[model samples]
Target: MRTSSGAGELLVELHRDNGVPLHQQLESAIRTRIRAGLLRPETVMPSTRALAQDLGLSRGVIVEAYQQLVAEGYLISRGGGYTLVADIAVVSPTAAAKPGAGPPRIDFRYSRPDVSQFPRAAWLRSVRRVLNETPNRSLAYLDGRGTIELRTALSDYLNRVRGTAARPENMMICNGFAQGSRLILQVLAAQGHTRLAVEDPSDNDLREVAAAAGLETVGIPVLNSGIDVDALERSGADVVLVTAAHQFPTGAVTSADTRAALVAWAGQGNRLVIEDDYDAEYRYDREPVGAMQGLAPDRVAYAGTASKTLAPGLRLGWLILPSWLVEPMSQAKLMDDRGSPVLDQLAFADFVAHGEFDRHLRRMRPRYRELRDTLVERLAARVPELEPVGVSAGLHVLTWLPADLSEEALREAALARGLGVYGLKPYWVSGDGPAGLVFGYGSLSRQEVVEGIDLLAEVVAALRS
Candidate 1:
């Protein structure tokens, strides 16, 4: 074992007669230590001469190993400066897996899109166009309300497609739906709003955001048509968040009557509605429903994201605020990271303006619809006992299990078989709900969807036995 001491130490054990070259062995040892997080980012390494002297190897071998590590991004070198580990070093297999884990689980967790289908060429074109056309001054710290170009483009797109009354001046670009919701809740809390009414069994992550923003959350039941307005009114919440076009975990579109009642409920007091139109573009059975914000723009704060339609990693979302919120929300946004990335905002603006965004959705809608259809059909055929609940829109469907089966037991069995399935119990605020599972099919292929369902059926049969 040969070790070199410095601000960062290198430990290498070399085989004198092994076929591998000394340089190769030294490079491998350093790479492994960096990946295992033993050699942290920015830690300076010993001089090549010092390391060579310590290991009884030629200086040329140490230099070759250091150069190789630098080329591979495992190390960084500057002129006349000691080599240092790259700042991007991360623990890999250790962070992602246990010591003796089984094969990768087939993840069916909902709300993820097929990232492989991302429009790379189109996105590259948009980014290139932005870089070419955008003025240098425009790239500086921008308005917290986002770039005027994107807001203008989004204003037109939302108005034309979603029936929103969005204006360039009234919208703020955010990191994503999660951050958008947090900003809104923070504004509401600052405005003396105490209670936020959310749909029961809604996205638990959003509920946690509401709590973090200093607003107490109250759950209102979600009926087949939509959120129970009567219960919302009775809950005495000053603000409400809803997925009116297509509710999550249930796929219930809010009826016209309920939309009216909700707007009316907001009109009666100092109330507001936060509409998370997360995935309203993929309705296959009929034309998608228009946004609820159109009916009552003054009372509704609408939020839309590029996560489901384009890709989540983009972290791009926009909020169409009520006129009263425009100033406060923009201020809050300014205080929260000085707004999202200007380059992404500009590229997205160009993406939407050139109709690339529309074309992308046009291409993806049917693909997602097919995935949803296959999952529903397979569930109905192989495990008829599990009734598919919401299948009309969105990337996932919720299936209610038979009363005799246990959600926990079935989920554990599915995991043992390397299948990842989520249950509705965790989404409920009370943590008590009917037995059901949410199957997200957007990220899986047609054959994978079939195989997943087949495996699930086997698990069900075995559990019954």
Candidate 2:
């Protein structure tokens, strides 16, 4: 059938001798196009007369097909008899599974804070204060380094709290760690740095980002203390990305000697270190360790985010660059989204300057500590076969399962019982490791943790039997 010139070129095929009616063929074709996303939502359809003339079909057939589609909710009939595609959800043909699948009842997913504890009243006050005091010019396009008020506030806060040597002029406020890491990797790649070394069992996102930036990634083994520096030196990588303060998925803090050796390694070849200091706010046992960036400010680029401290919804993060790399990174930031939202940055600045941020953290630290304790205690009492790894810091506890147990089987069994648990295998670059699971207690209550662990014990016993 010929395409109609009207309504953005409506094309349809009809079968007459094949025994299927012309109207039925038209309706099925249109429905298939809409379902396949070839016809977008709200797309106008050709009038019956025009389509019929183009296809050499009777007007009655076109009218019948249009009416049937409208009755089936695939098309919307509007004023003046115009038909438009309905704005219904489109299921992609390539999708592995359908969307809207509900999450498990008891989820132990990590990297999220207790959003219910967000200081709504305090944050509102800060935003309202910023709106009243900020000048009209402050709302316009700002420097890619972000608002000066926030940089100054963060410079002071990071220094005092994390013992970082950050300066207001050398920091860039980003959407979150996701953006900050990308910006840094892009800059490094542009500067002719080719190889990036990452922790063997670290977050897989790092490897993906490095590859996106056109750099080769090498996985360096992580010892109990931290990343294996000796292996890192032999890898010939010019830069390394590490979560030194608290390693992710396996929660091991870098020892002081290893930190020094890492700095020395960078110094020998003028290498750089990208430190992801996420979730350093909550330390249950004692005072948190000072940041490695503090030791070698010139060699380390430090990144911190509000995802773990405040809420992931905030999408707020900051990067403290070495003086030499500031200009390039600032230019990259300008090209990347023209800097983060200004009003949110100003509000966070006010939050920090007024000590509201500290007060909020003070209230959350103990609460998270209690949840971590409960998770560890219940797991120990019920499923003593699973051993808890990592220190008493951050939002998650990495647990090593019994050597005989299969991580994938346990995860599937737990999911079948309406409980969600994450396995540690996917985090490895090689995907060959021991059977382990990560237990995130951030968003869970004390009772949820107890119940989840008890259910996990049942699953483990059944698997063994």
Candidate 3:
């Protein structure tokens, strides 16, 4: 258990007592510190040597703990000799879906669902109803679009809850957001629009996915309010993708004025607006923000998913394209997966039609809000220098760490203590202020939230002192 010079002094509270296993306890402690907003994202973690020495444990134990987090996507490997709190939110819509066996670990990186609380019984019940009620032969390549029943239900629900527009015919049910996005790219490219204007700080993986599909993405500067319209226009890209509901890391809801500006641009210029309504549900402060698609259905393409609301494993998402893009995008989708799995689509339709889905959301939205509140209060108490962005809505909160505390040093300290935090640089095109760390409360229980944030504060103290 050799230590890293002066870094050996960093402290980690390892409770061998109490019934919990050391590995889980360590993981819990790390999670607590991260949520409390002490460890900024992208901060490098200490070597296992330093962690084992400081915690008075075998290096093997520290190594195993670190490996667990890395497997869970909370920690990333850097080149020379270090581990880091990797940006967990880098999602590529292009990546093929891989199967996960069971519940996801508390990843605090992506906007995910609470696995422990998912209404399995209700979903099963819906599955049973759909299985028995629907024709057996209907399951084979019936609608390239989503089930008519589901589309009808979504038409009313999305309009009521998210302010999405139009007749059920306007909505084309596809796979998840990634699949849907790919189809849209194909449609725009087919129409001879090869360039897309994307948010500078938007998902890197998503941009890369578009690029893979033969569309050149032009980066558009995103201000605290919304995308820089002037910069976007100058980019000369005819297509655009926006995570409007709660801007990814920054969590700024597209202002009403900005929404209007986007609407005007798409309306007058014939530009296509691909609206990734990221987390439109889960609003604690007030009414959930409305969708940009509703503002100009003819120009805006509305995409929503059950990934955040239900779970990503369901592989269920929807896209409502404008009239012009509909035929082309739908044609592209037919050639893609030919449409998502009929079984899952039918099950989801039953879930929504029977009102079981809404009930689930109603129950979980408040729980998520409470978790968010706990994270904010705890972070403020622990690290006064760290300021949080996007506390009002969304699953994660971004913390701006003090510039004096090197992100590298803080990350090392947090890793020594088994902490996880995502740095903001990954979200930027090109800019440097202080580091931005993302804290996701959706997957964590209220108790985990408290403990995670507290540990983070302790790590911050060790780094600076």
Candidate 4:
């Protein structure tokens, strides 16, 4: 058996005379290894000097290759001249199946945040500070709810940002929004709540989660103003979930009149309002709407997650529960996983307390806005009939398509063109809604967004013909 080191054992067959530059050839070879899982994540690579010397190439060539890979997220520089592979999903050699028979080269799926812009240095600093500051006894079981430091920090952060009257005692941190929803539903079901009403065109997984928790899910219509309050009242559900700031798929902001109506409706029936404040931070136009929890704190159970703001891999979410629901939700959280990891909670507290989180958001907003603008502009030029629905906020936008192209047809056409376009159909509960496409500009670059939409326009033309 032979063991391989990245520097000496790694194989690269660079072609100098094959019309490809040495740097590009080296970059492609390394990328191929990563895609094929030949080089695993965190695998340390040889120094530029060593690799260049071994390959009989200038150090500048290896440096250029490494830089390109880093920008593409295939590699990461760990500072102090250390480089390692990034832990991204490994691409299959036949990932796109001859370009048109498999997954798209450009994924426009709406669930991801712009992870490339993640503040690694800031996060590392926070982690270091937490490690240095956290007492050993603090590492032991303190509270199933979460570390008080995090809850305290989150309480203040939410108050300032989302306008929620969050209190440390009333907050419970969970794995993510999904877990938070599950626990809330479990507690509600245990308390004799039977029905949960959700937006008609919302995440299907959310409906499934409610159903799994033994709550009957009722689908209510979502108009331009937001969830139809009249329809919601008519559903006769004991609990309702809403994405008030920016609705999923459609991006409708819950209007003041509708907000009042929903709160009134909740008051009338003593129903619970589970406000999913998922992506309220990235508002490109005007001031962001405040969380509905603030308007009716006693009635609303506010849920938020770092999945959208930071990265999904963080698996950090918090719920600002009403006084009555805190103990039960906290107990439920305890039984679920004892508690979320303490290290992350402590580090996040430091991150928020030191204002680094705010700084990161401020830095990312402009870049994301740039990507959004490029996506919208290119789509308007290429596909004039595609109307972008929803407010200019969040990482994704829903574009209502012309009647000629069905959502499924458009999605398939886009896929065939190596462009991943998600149909709005799956988001709908009743399976009957207008055709639309959801474009997520979170991960892709501005140039990539433009190229993808242009390809999508061509796909639509072909489908129309």
Candidate 5:
């Protein structure tokens, strides 16, 4: 319960005589103070220089202590010479921080799914069946690479549904994409590969996770034509992470020609390709698009999760590894964690084997299609100038707002109206392009969509005038 995150009003003395490093000891002492409820969350910490001067220690020592806490999600740095205790105070602490309050409205945030139709009965039935049939080996710590049932089912599911040509041995289950990413990065770092390129307009906070492992993000502009291949060539990244099925924030599918070109480029340069097959199953217009990982499994690393498909609460996902990288990835995965929960894995496998999985997907498809169409239509009518991103094969729509209305003003205006929307500016590290909103319709109702967007439209109109 002791967390080293607080700004003390009293001049605390440091004990440098302990066997533990002075800074680490100091960090632990502060953490104890925090858990005891003596220090408050969001309390500002003294500058590293000031703390160092007071303790008669080097500034690097205090800075290192602060950085370690920050990496562990205990403290937050607001820059401009300020560090503060992280948000929320709790009696007990663990790695899993409690989730934010009950669901959100107009929650255009990503990684969402239609929870109303999450196949509750089907899942419970599967769990019951698994409990009945699971043997002694199933209960023990078997292969971290997942059970044969889920892998075989996934092999068929991916090939038949998601256009993934994977064999049973090629797939392994993990907690989710976040773990999968770290595993892949660990392998790449082990191979001395560091500089990597990703979509310019990409997720903001994750870049730091890569950076911590000594990987630098080389940005590539995301055009309506998928990634700008020319820009990618110019950037000269050692590896590339792309969302080919339906690109996040832009929803642009990697065109077939571009897919071939990317494969060829990777083969020629022997570079790694990280394919995030996110939200590939929720397309509305037509059948789901083919996964890029199938084009050259040897070069492409495929990652998918049940977060969007089932629900974010289900921390279950699978990665299909190529023949060459499979062993290394498995080793890295083992190093990270022994494996996912056997109970959930067995239950999911049972669900897939019984055809309940496919039935659930079929049932949810129409509802998602209707919701996607509703959101797109409402966006068009309310904000005529804003264009929704193409190839609707995902959970959310990325609508481009006109340059006349700045994202900064519009976000402020929308929040004032009790509506939530995030701007695309934070995603772009290369200083490229206009801002837009990533609108998620998964957890919202038809009425809420119309009303929230109407609020956004009003904000735009005000900014334009």
Candidate 6:
């Protein structure tokens, strides 16, 4: 409850003339802050005498307040008259149950990553190195294609890790995936490419992104084997954006044969494919699949980002274009923010070249896998009838709901119980399918995942009743 006076001290305001005792008022204030997470666990607090003097209260008042908090398990009396927040302070069940009522809800949205695992020290080292090593001229506005150092580093990393045949000249770094997709859509629309085909149960926001560029987006069916190549052909779209390595919301790996068929389809019609290699790192079932761009680099455009691996706020993403589209995409990027920031690009380059990026991913893979396993196990124990599909690779899994339960109803019921459950309907372009839920395990701890599922199971039971 109490924080150190030096820098970590909790600031509390008191009204002496109020009817409430000073000790009780102080105790309530500290308890509230502790539950709110403003005063984190294990934070050292000022000495009782020091605090009493600061608040213009008697030393006895501070001592009584501290004793009460200690008894309640909010603060602990350390040796030498020091008081600290308990490492595992017990928040009331009702307080912990509903997330929005107390702390922030444990969000299960699929687009997130556990940013708490981001390598701060490694990133700082890279940033420091970039500051020291980068030439002065490199800071100025340069080619819209991005810095040669970063493009080269990305080219090598993508080729080695994702099996993409990326060349520095073809790489264009833009602000995150949103901007990357926008730039590509703009270029395609300029080339008289009017129709775009996307996976049926893919990101709905993409339809708006395509519309901005005057291209119409049509939904192509997505099966267990990945996007239905036959359905894609029938759609007759000029360009297709696919998450081949691991499809979003479904985690369906595009099969080898289907990948070849897609390549052929693009070749025959002079169509273009954009390989959105999002969250390709955290695969657990087997060695992660390589990028589909390698199959036909000339027919496909490869896109990757630091959002999943690093943090989304960094606003960093890159696209490797084919020879025909490189200039156009580069020009499109030039018009969009005059290219991504150079400092971040350089730091990321350092992070990659020095092998810290690989090290960070190595550390995160097992943690994310453990979280995914915990979610599956808890849901199975509670709602055995609910089987989670696509538990293979990505941060999320899809589970088909019983015929009676609508995705919307289940989501609302779960939210009422303080669980942030998401439905697959919004992602569906046509909103066609059995009602299903998408559970994103990233951005949540293993404990939170289990607790959320337990609440979700209860919600489902109530819905069934």
Candidate with maximal TM-score: 1
In model 1, what are the clashing residue pairs, if there are any?
none
lDDT tens readout by residue for model 5, 90-183 = 5665547777544334666666687887889999999998888888788877566878888888888888887877988888888988888877
Q: Rank the candidates by TM-score, best first.
A: 1, 2, 4, 6, 5, 3
Clash count list over all predictions? 0, 0, 17, 0, 2, 2
List clashing residue pairs in candidate 4. Answer: none
Q: Arrange candidates by lDDT, descending.
A: 2, 1, 4, 6, 5, 3
| lDDT tens per residue, model 4, 1-465 | 113244677778977789999999999999989888888888888889889888999999999999999999999897788888888888676777665366679999887888877889999999999899788998998576899999999999999988998999999999999999999999999999999999989989988888888999888999989999988878889899999999998999999999999889878755899999998999998677898898888899999999988999999999999999999988888888889999999999999999989999999899889998998888889998987877489999888877788877877777777889888888888888888888888889888998998898888889878
Please report, in order, the local distance difference test score of every candidate based on alpha carbons.
Answer: 0.89, 0.90, 0.76, 0.89, 0.79, 0.86
Point out the worst 10-residue segment of candidate 5 by lDDT: 1-10
Q: List ranges where model 3 is wrong by over 4 Å.
A: 1-107, 431-434
| Clash pairs, model 5 backbone | 3-31, 4-31
After superposition, the stretches of candidate 4 with alpha carbons farther than 4 Å from their true spots are: 1-102
What value does the lDDT take at residue 462 in candidate 6? 95
Per-model TM-score on C-alpha atoms: 0.83, 0.80, 0.75, 0.79, 0.76, 0.78
Tens digit per residue, CA lDDT, model 6, 232-325: 8888798999999888878789999889988998998669999899889878887778898888999999889888888899899999899998
Residue 114 of model 5, lDDT score: 72
The list of candidate 1 runs beyond 4 A from truth reads 1-104
On a 0 to 100 scale, what is the lDDT of residue 55 in model 1? 87
> In the order shown, what is each candidate's alpha-carbon RMSD?
7.3, 7.2, 18.2, 11.1, 13.3, 9.2
Off by over 4 Å in 6: 1-104
Worst 10 residues of 1 by lDDT: 1-10
Candidate 2 has a TM-score of 0.80
